[model samples]
Target: MMMLNIDDSGMARPYLRENIVFNHAHTEISTGTTLFACQFDGGVVIGADSRTSSGTYVVNRVTDKLTPLAKGIFCCRSGSAADTQKVADIVRYQLDFHRMQMDRDPTVLEAAVACRSICYAYRDDLTVGLFVAGWDESLGGQIYSIPLGGMLLRQPAVTGGSGSTYIYGYFDREFRSGMTKEECAKFVSTGVALAINRDGSSGGCVRLAIISKDGVERRLIKGDCVPRFSIC
Candidate 1:
């Protein structure tokens, strides 16, 4: 039942009672990160900013957002840190078991599907999104974006998180098919740096993972080394 209060003006104002139910998961929690994956000619490059925030405060300055799910597959995470970390942990365990049973590395699509299954199951309880990128013998390289609510899309280039909103136009103009490895890396790094400069919730160093048939190479571009552009 609702409680009503009469003010000096004699107007009744209804208020929720103590017994009313509220879903905390639906509450807004400010989260920040810049994540993106670009599929180049021979492989894929995934990158993310290191800033982790809660509301207006910066919590972690050097958190790694790129998580390894399989032999050559990795995911870029954004959203609640605990939620994304737990989801990645579960997906990694399942993929490891699948690989052992099949005596081969799990495919990129298989890994992405595993993530989607978990994310979909907890869609209402979790606020997380992932970009799955990897290289396999069958498919040279692939990039799959599994956003909130578990919707999956395969794209040549994709970006996410708060910082992404500032770089949509940048990607549209710079991204192209058949890009070389160096070109792709530069594109990813530049785009992320741009986001960090503009997004208050996104800052810190840029972490990158370049995946190909050879293996995965990790790179850390310090904040000082990140490119800056004048927005004025």
Candidate 2:
């Protein structure tokens, strides 16, 4: 149940990792990678390549990268598995609290704030990187990203990871705002193509999810993929 962690003063805190053992539902180990999220005029498009690394070598290839929170929001992670699930758990609990207290689903902004707060709870060692996408009618499909230990950040869109710089470069050149769902999907396809190509740790499959008012629209896995989406 213990993993290595150096505290602020370069002191080891075995308890931080040991405190939450895998025996209980409190922990789940995960390794992840480049996730794509785009919000368009109609809804949201989220794409995550199935690649994971334990160290420098590929460890998993057919991983599910995106998880829907509700009718309009989704979350993705690309870091330590234990930390990411803890962050997700925070989201689940907070949403429940808000739904009962405020009488509405937590807004994307509110969710971002909550997630980022979770990231900071680790201070420095257990930080999490998140890509959040959803429908903010006023913004009409929005993309926002948070860095490790980040606070409230409002971006039109974002990408994260050791390969983030490369993904962002692709996004800057390829991402199109105010797009329709079709255009957004196309844009996401292009982004995934770039990530899988440049990020050695990303590949095997892609789980694509689209979000709208009605609900989330999921795409076929690689084998069942239709034309371009399955090209990998």
Candidate 3:
């Protein structure tokens, strides 16, 4: 039996379920998620494809990993199962708390703080890689990313495991200025295709969510042409 390495970013482990465990316990499988965010005049476009795998086993396919955090704020994650679940719970709690205390809706900045707090608390136990999108008050449309160390970035980003290369390239070319949300939707569809075709660790279903100044809307676009994410 052997113990594996663990860190704030992520860890590598070998299978030894009975006699030993990696990180904290059993291996959580090499899974990942990729989220693409674009800042447009009208709103933010977030397209995430569902593809979770464990070694040779396709654990979950066509899953919904992207969700709306606030009215116009959306989040997408691809990383440790532990971190994902934890962040989600914290965000939910924060939103609930804010509603109870202020009697007002939580904003994107607040949501980011909630997420960062979780990362700081269990900074040693989780690998939280996430992207946050919304209409920035000053910048109009804004896209931000928070990786392991709470580093925020805005660059038409990508987050996930092995299949990142394929998806990142696809996003870079298709993403540009003045593209409509609909066009970005198509671009995301293409990105999903590239990930499914090239990355073995991802691809079962696709979930797409878009957010605007008005609100957030999601749909599952799995058809002959592309995979769906949320709404059926």
**lDDT winner:** 1
Q: What does each candidate score in C-alpha RMSD? A: 6.6, 9.1, 8.3
Q: What local distance difference test score does each model get?
A: 0.89, 0.69, 0.66
Score candidate 3 by TM-score against the native: 0.76
TM-scores, one per candidate = 0.86, 0.75, 0.76
lDDT of 3 by residue, 96-144 (tens): 7887899877767677777877776777777877777766454556666
Whichever of 1 and 3 has more TM-score, that candidate is 1
Runs with alpha carbons beyond 4 Å of true place in candidate 1: 1-31
In model 2, the runs with Cα more than 4 Å from the true position are: 1-32, 136-140, 221-232
List clash counts for every candidate, in order.
0, 1, 14
Kindly list the per-residue Cα lDDT of model 1 for residues 1-232, writing each as its tens digit.
7678776799887764653445544544434789978998889999999987766567678888898989999999988888998899999999999989999989999999999999999999998989999999988899999999999889999999989999999999999998999899999999999999999988999999999999999999998888889947
State the displacement of the C-alpha of residue 105, model 1, in Å, after optimal TM-score superposition: 1.0
Error of 3 at 65 (Å): 0.3
- In model 1, the worst 10-residue window by lDDT is 19-28
